[model samples]
Target: MSISDQIERLATAKANIAAAIESKGVDVPEGASISDMAALVVKIPVFTEEEVFLAAHPVGSYFKTASKGDPGEIYGGRWELDPSLGAFRWRRIE
Candidate 1:
């Protein structure tokens, strides 16, 4: 993929994750990007195991694993960017 494509994918993943968290009633920082959230997740020492896993592989490794049909793919269901909203929304493929 081109650099632009990679960036778009990363942004899409971040937006999707942010939306998911908010759907669960968590208050994400206003306008905070995924990179910001990952930084916080990594520094905080009291995250759940799943949180740690997500934080540890926020981008590269996460996408790689997902492509390989691994846990990363299962964690967030599936996502697509919503251009109108300027963020990603999750959907179940099934």
Candidate 2:
């Protein structure tokens, strides 16, 4: 199934989901819409990939790998620049 389909399935989850997100520093409340969660994944981050990795992974450094083609074809993909977003992110290639 598609990511949208999977998201539709998770739309039925409880408020604890929002609580979990908020606990991590995001201000979203338990009443936030499911689309909010979905958007978080696809949204263009305000920070650069190196910044994000530094913030999340601390000691770890992120490496950039050239796309063999359309990255969506790879099974386990790595971070690549989304020109539209101006940030690099881990996009799952199915």
Candidate 3:
């Protein structure tokens, strides 16, 4: 799915679920939707090879090996630039 589709899914989730997002003991202002949260968050899927590594190291491995390891046929995969990571992250609406 596209970013737009993911954003829409997040928006739909926001409509269905209510959770408080706070920083420094203050809640973020309204109009900040789940899509905004999703923008701030990125999900890196666990592939078969990475599964063992992830099981051993729950935190995550280096991007180079992680990207190359057992990435079986990514159907409808896309990438988004993560400014903090200074790299493109794979994104797919699972």
lDDT of 3 by residue, 1-94 (tens): 9999998997777754334334223343467666665543333233575455344433322222235322224322233322335343433222
Error of 1 at 74 (Å): 31
Cand. 2 TM to true fold: 0.27
Per model, how many backbone clashes are there?
Answer: 0, 0, 0
| Cand. 1 Cα-lDDT | 0.55
Better candidate number, 1 or 3, judged by TM-score: 1
Q: Which stretches of candidate 2 lie over 4 Å from their true place?
A: 1-12, 41-94
Name the better of 1 and 3 by lDDT.
Answer: 1
Task: Tell me the tens digit of each residue's lDDT in model 1 across 1-94.
Answer: 9999999998898888877666655667988877777655543345577666566544433232113243535564343322234223322331
Residue 89 displacement (Å), model 2? 37
Clashes of 1: 0
Candidate 3 regions exceeding 4 Å error are: 19-29, 32-94
1 or 2, greater by lDDT: 1
